[model samples]
Target: MSKPKDYTLLVIDDELQVRRFTEVSLSPHGYEVHSAESGREGIELGTKLNPDAIILDLGLPDMDGLDVLSSLKSWYQGPIIVLSVRDDEDSIVAALDSGAHDYIRKPFHLGELLARLRLALRNNQANQTSPVYTSGNLSVDLSSRRVTVGEREIKLTVTEFELLKVLIRHRGKVLTHNQILTEVWGPKSVEHIQYLRVYVGHLRQKLEADINKPRLILTEPGVGYRLQNLDLLKEGMTASEAALIAEKVD
Candidate 1:
């Protein structure tokens, strides 16, 4: 794909080599690139530059990368691709849940990274139109980051919101535990099935009219979970999540 001309990109990494490599690669391809050597500098540059997108490194010299991600997200809504050497699931999940749009492991291919950057930019532009997704009484305002059921607003933590967003984004589709984990939390967290169970239960208790009989989120036994029958009213939650919700109630 041809690169889009005049698009500004901010690369935030402590390593001089990574910063130089990104600048050299992206500059020739039509991106006006800027570099920052620390989390504080990155945040400041990002705030001042207001780039179209950002490439963030998780392992910063001064502060944790996740903290930078969170702080930047509070003000910057642009697509942020986390570029990091921390390939572990927990780190990836934390970054994603904190609002990183994409996570790319370090030692990445320039071609693949460029492709991801383009895709992120394209998606961000498409999403600006404001799409609202609904299932029964539950509604998710993707643009506003607001969720509600009937007349009541549902309050969710950042992680819970991201988790719910993933499920709602793929409503009516059964996403395996691994798929959902990778989307919301990151790749390494696929084995943390227990975390999924807990969050699903929390969602049920908040959204379902009757927690014991949830009408939205459905379980696929050992497979995964999905929001069932978006265009139609479903009867109840799947057994596992329902069971967990029941436990919460009791």
Candidate 2:
């Protein structure tokens, strides 16, 4: 589907005042805002309309916020930032685990929420599928959702695409299992390290010349994973010598 000219947002919260306030805050910034008074309505809107981002409140009349987040994650690729009055550790952790990209407790400054939205948009640019970059033999198009490795287009699942995006975002930064899990799968996913291992292995099989000992997606044993183009990091090269690596993901 062709993306709309403006960034579109879906705000899901049972509180009328909160939903209205968020809509007011975001609309002026050139975002097309949509609102839902309950979790069920929000889910329907999210599934039917491919909005650029979502702002969901955990305490909904129809369902728990974490459940809403998890259900949406199976289908959406764009960011979903959670808003709620509950700030308990478990609640926060669950929201993240359910696939929320970011969170803000109730009584948050509208400005701060706006800033977080901007960051999510900045990050979503990678998922745009535009013809973006090439490293070695891989060609990535963020805007078109097309990838070509050695002149052949590669097919990837939603989860695989998202996994690839997370690795590319931290290109040189060695992302620990927990950090990667939270960022890619949500905070509640800290214990699912095996899921990470399996997907990383899949990525290696698809991208590496030899899957047994990978090159592009480097594993750090007990630490985490670092993804970098090996040619850009030959011996004696400074970290600064690493080329600006890029990947198209959403």
Candidate 1's residue-wise lDDT over 122-181, tens digit each?
556544544787667778887788999889999988988898888766544445677788
Superposition error at 244 for model 1 (Å): 38
For all the candidates, what are their Cα RMSDs to the real structure? 12.4, 11.0
TM-score of each: 0.56, 0.55
Error of 2 at 78 (Å): 0.7
Pairs clashing within candidate 1:
93-185, 214-236, 214-237
Candidate 1 — which residues are off by over 4 angstroms?
Answer: 1-4, 130-250
RMSD score of candidate 2 (Å): 11.0
lDDT score at residue 61, model 1, on the 0-100 scale: 90
lDDT of each: 0.76, 0.72
Candidate 2: stretches off by over 4 Å: 1-5, 127-250
Task: Report the lDDT of model 1 for residue 167.
Answer: 74
